[model samples]
Target: MFPLSTSINLTLPIEDPILKFLLILVIILAAPLILNKLKIPYLLGLIIAGAVIGPHGLNLVLRDSSIILSGTAGLLYIMFLSGLDMDMSDFKHNSWRSLVFGLYTFCVPLGLGILAGHYLLGFPLYSSILLAGLFASQTLIAYPIVSKLGIARDKSVTISVGGTVITDTLALLLLTIIVGMATGNVDDHFWWRLTLSVVLCIVVIAVLFPLLAHWFFKHVSDNISQYIFVLALVFLGAYLAQLAGLEPIIGAFLSGLALNRLIPRTSPLMNRIEFVGHAIFIPFFLIGVGMLIDYRAFFRDWESIEVAAVMILLITAAKYIAAFLTQKTFRLSKDQRTVIFGLSSAHVAATLAAVMVGYNVILGYTPEGEPIRLLNESVLNGTILMILATCTISTFATQRGAHNIAMGNAQESDDDRSRRPEEHILIPVANERSAEELVAMSIMLKKPRDPNGLYALNAIDNRVEDPNVEKRARKILDAAASAAAGSDIYLQTLLRYDVNISNAIVSVARERNITDIVMGMHHMTPAVPGIAGIPVPAGPAIGRMAADVLGHSNITTFLYNAEQPLSTVKRHLIVVPEKAEKEAGFQMWMNRIHQLARNSGAKIIVFAPASTMPYLRTFGRRRPANIDFVVFEQWDDLPSLEHDLRQDDCLWFVMSRRERVSYHPAMSRIPLYLEQYFAGYSYVLLYPVQAGPGDSRYL
Candidate 1:
């Protein structure tokens, strides 16, 4: 059905509508997937693909038929989606920055445009005013780009996008007023009319759209019909804007804002709308823009090219200057300054539309009639070139630039590093769950303690300075020491003044290289831990202790109450199917278990699957004499011999290594399922030996 080649087309005559629709659909569907695989921007790819299939390029399709209608419809659809993506809540969040940065973007660009038109090209004053207004318009369809980039986790991206929404809205309103005046419609009453219109529009929107939208969404089915209603509102808003002598796009955007507030947070309508927009309209619209490019006109107009380059440089410089000044004036950091500039660099879609409207409808600049209309062509072609260049460059460069700036500022210094917490300190407290808490802490902090061993610490509260407090703490420590009978444990006491006990514990731990720490759960200080310290003065300071012990070295910590017994210690010596020592944690855990068994005079037998012999060889050198290992061929046969080992007073340590799936080994299910059956009799350890740093999830 596609007009692929002349031979096929001539032989198999096809229905035009079906063929056209299929061709467009194919382009829309395939372009993103193909380009996405290549790691290229989808919009850029779509544009190039469109140009390839356009009349001026490969001539694979004609634009005179249904393709043209569909393409135009795609643009409108994309524009509507763009409006919907403009989150007004985001605007409110960054209103101050957006207002300042947006005003700066609009004003600086307009000033440059005036200079370019009036001085550089010597255009009429009124025409220059219109041109300046058009150039000043910059639209940031940030939502889709942010979603695609998957950078919502970055705070800078969130702030920049929030500011962008406000910036775009304010700039559009300013442009509307400027364009209205440029058209010579308003006399001396321009300001009054503009103010009244904005006020009236705001009031009408405030009262009508919100209430109506709220009612509609509250009772609506939130399905295809909801999307249709939104689509209809977009056109209606635009139509209303036209009646008010403002750009229709403004109304469309406003309608979106109203709907955004009214729509439920978990609406299926958004998903369906996003699906249609992203899968079809957006790609098609971008490609259509690319196909419309006039390469010849661009090359022939050297002066226009020069002017365009100058405009870009000037606009960019002006934005940076504004950003720099605003940041400096407000005492904003260097990273914030860079982010502001990056947000300012967003110029596309709306900019092009404004330019086209100005040149064609307002200025009467068209590529027809006498003299070949070189000026009109230059402006039109130049605008397109500028839009693409600015948008792509700004989006990518700003993202990278902002990222670098943020990283540079956020990087930890040695001082910061010193202040950083290594373990989360638990303040000892009396509670019902204190025992369970201790048990959980012991299980979680199973990571090997420092070579020096765990330093069990307690702090004397500043409030009472009672000698009884130390006696009570010592009694708890003695009990813990007895429970951990064979393990190396050291007791330490701190006499404190007015400082937080959590901070004191953390500071001491880092200095001593204390691996895992246990503490009481009671608040005695008001001071919270800094990047380095711990929480002071209240309930078992578990949060503070965890924070302190988290990031230093490879130390994993356990926070347990002094009263509870250690629950479920299963240190599995995992032999990889055909591999040697892999994960450091696995090696440490197994080594510690072997040491415990040897020291306690307990016999430990390793029941491994037959496939793990190659990896077992690595353990023979330091293997404990009381430990013996046997290999089994099948999992079903494990229980028969496992019963014999238990009867022999030997601990059967069955270890399994999983394969790989997203950093976890693939065949982990065998060990996992088997562990469920031998819950208490035998300790089963399922160790996913990380293959490399990239396989960190196994860790």
Candidate 2:
């Protein structure tokens, strides 16, 4: 039994733990959805909701230790996700750009902040530099938005993400120096200790964490345990970072980087990790940040308001200037510049941490002999206001910029003009092991503006209608749905008990008017046999189901055999046959390949016939400016070129249905050649949509 409170006053603070927890839970659940209906970013909604219910607003809840802990966890979670979601290949390629932006973003704000602190606030040099460091450090609060828009792999976004890590690290280092100076610990000994600790922390995280995680994942079979272990590893990294005199968020982020390759971006484990953060930890953190605002302070202290305005203006101007300069140096588009600015503008995590540390340091004594705090309440309040303003700007700017980029891509591609605006893709899930990967690939290849999302189908053998079999099929579809959800893509699940899997797939696809079918390659190859009276080679032939689907349907089909995790891929070697450019599905496959290159951060080299080079180059022009495209006029030299392929390269075969243009006899030997020569590489086989009945073919 629970006792009811006597009154529910708007200004009455609720102190009961259970009541406070419930109230917050309710607010977390309702606020986002309500604000979403009105077309608002859920993040902004959470912050605003937090302020409304905080102690200074209606006084529905008071700040407590629990809030502090949750907020801390949320902050770490945000940083961890940022690292985990980053494309390592892109990060490596753009590391230099990242460094440049890091220096620009860091130095500009630091300089401006120092001037403001010294001239406007009348602060000493040390205090002013510390304030500048705070201005320089920013959180990627809007990065998730770029990720949601599926353009996270863009060079601009990748460079911005890399810059965040660099700036935050440098800023935290400055904080350590300031804190040391304030506490009379600024000496050669202090520098030695800091350097040693940081080195040790990096070594342990970069070397030991990955080794342990690999061993644990290999032995630990339980899914729940795996997720728990990842969380534990994150905390362990944070703890180690703290021990090494670095921020815990730094540890969390490094831990993510350590384990990045181990966890596939499309795996169930990755889905679970993102789900927990976005659904719980991150929202809680945003709310806690909101609770920190004391609205009355602004009215009582004009100095605080003035400080906040100055901080906002200076920080915003510095970040924009940095982004603008980077844009000119890199020859980036206006939207890309906005994206960089949006991603690097918000002041949170490191900013707040530095402020709290600054608040506790003692600089001198006042006339009354009271200890003078290094940072006053007015500075703290101003910092909070800056966070709110920057967050709002970041959210809106990122949304608009990402959207514009997506639109630009769609319009620039001439291939898109010939295709339907709506895309209906059918993903047949037969193997649970590869279903998520196939679905994720489908999502990546899909046009951002496509109205029709995806259809996940699991057609079981109708004769053996065991309840368990149906359950298993449903489970597979569920996994596909979860994978789609992680990417913010809509997925419709379909389960049918049918005797003929191929017929069932064709039926569903036709009924749904699906334009494409994506499926995993079957392990077992069919016996050598002719298909529709056409003689087909027997050696390592495509699976019977895939052959049947290709034979029966005119819809485009993509058969993927992922030998390695998609994360490790660095290049795409697409073999385009003679007359491939004349195929009806040529442009569509080109678009998909381009998308794959963008998503994987891989360069593309198209091996096409001399006649097909012009079309291939045109297709290349449609891709993102950062994507590297090379066209080689060598369609007949695939066998000789096997030695040129690196282990990380993915070989793609642009194939076609029988009796179709570009359907060469060499296509029949692909399976055999691939098994013998390219067994260790990741590969995809694409069958473009068939020509209309009235269309002529050279074959």
| Model number with the top lDDT | 2
Report the Cα lDDT for residue 147, model 1. 42
Give lDDT tens digits, candidate 1, residues 1-699.
886655434322233656756876788778768977886655566666766776656666655545545555455554455444443433444457656665666677778878877898777665565566555655543334544443332334444544444544555565565556665566768777766776676556556775665456545643556677767776676666556645555666566655653442212355566667777666666666666654555577687686567656766776677667767665776755665566556466566655655555443443763332212555666665666566565555455555565455346333443774343323232233352333223323332221123334555547766767766766655544332332222323233333655556656655676543443333223345432222222322234444443322233232222221122121222223323234444554454444444322233455555555445545644543344566744444444544444321313232222232212232223333333444343332223223444566443
lDDT per residue (tens digit) for residues 120-227 in model 2: 988878888989999999998876677667677677887888888889989999999987887788998998999999999999999998788766765664669989
Question: How does each model score on TM-score?
Answer: 0.50, 0.78
Off by over 4 Å in 1: 1-15, 36-38, 61-90, 150-184, 188-196, 319-346, 361-375, 398-699
Per-residue lDDT, model 2, residue 538, is 64
Q: Ten consecutive residues with minimal summed lDDT in candidate 1?
A: 561-570
Model 2 residue 33 lDDT score: 72
Counted clashes in each candidate structure = 42, 1
C-alpha lDDT values of all predictions: 0.49, 0.80
Q: Which candidate number would show the highest TM-score if scored against the true structure? A: 2
